[model samples]
Target: MKNGEYFISKDKALLQTETIHQFLSRSYWANRRTLAQVQASIENSICYGVYHGTRQIGFARIITDWATMYYLCDVFIDEEYRGQGIGRRLVDLIVQSEELDGLTGVLGTKDAHGLYESFGFVRDPDRFMKRRPTNPWA
Candidate 1:
């Protein structure tokens, strides 16, 4: 989906590990995340990469069963690319994607509440649930 000079695509091949690793490693939520871990995460999820010409500018991913629910995470835009609506566009595509349209979506963010809220995400803390497996690092 082309919006202005940036385009969003659910192409895992379009993702650059260095970019994802760099941002995630420093991100408040995923600090010190490794490149290999990021690669595996991308490989297993429905990923969208936002690009400018040949360079990637942002990314979002959905971990879903393609049925009743989805968890959105690792969403970010490059520092130089912030303040633009690119991040919103990425979220829009994810929330409105055909496969996820009828499913419940959940996400955790210390900030950026306003961004998600605009897309119909409500902060119902009682609904959040998580359980870490022994091999979660894998």
Candidate 2:
């Protein structure tokens, strides 16, 4: 998807691991994540990257079986590029994409609930639960 000079792509080869690591490493949820861990995660998930020319500026990933449900996570837009609708467009493409059609979606966010809510996500505290791993990196 193209928006003016910025475009979004699922081309994993175009993903800049270092740039992604830089963004994720500073993000509240993934601050403790290592570069190697980020790389492995990217390799396993469907990754969406936003770019201007060749410089990557945003990213989001979905863990899905492409059958039943999908978990959207690690979403971010470069601090310099936040108000540009890049994050929304990136997510719009993901949720509206044929790959995730008709499947249940889930995500966790301490903030940005409003953003996701616009895309049809609602608070489901009663049914939602989490169990952190004993090994922090596991």
Question: Candidate 2 has what TM-score?
Answer: 0.95
Q: Estimate each model's TM-score.
A: 0.91, 0.95
Candidate 2: tens digits of C-alpha lDDT, residues 1-138: 889999999999999999999888788889888899999999999999999999999999999987899999999888889887888888899989998999999999988999999999999999988887788775
lDDT tens string, model 1, 1-138? 998889998878888889888989889977756788889899899899989998888988889988789999999999899998899888988888888988999999998999999999999887668785677555
Off by over 4 Å in 1: 131-138
Q: By summed lDDT, which 10 consecutive residues of candidate 1 come out lowest?
A: 129-138
- Mark the regions of model 2 whose C-alpha exceeds 4 Å error after superposition: none
Q: Could you tell me which residue pairs clash in candidate 2? A: none
User: What lDDT score goes with residue 63 in model 1?
Assistant: 95
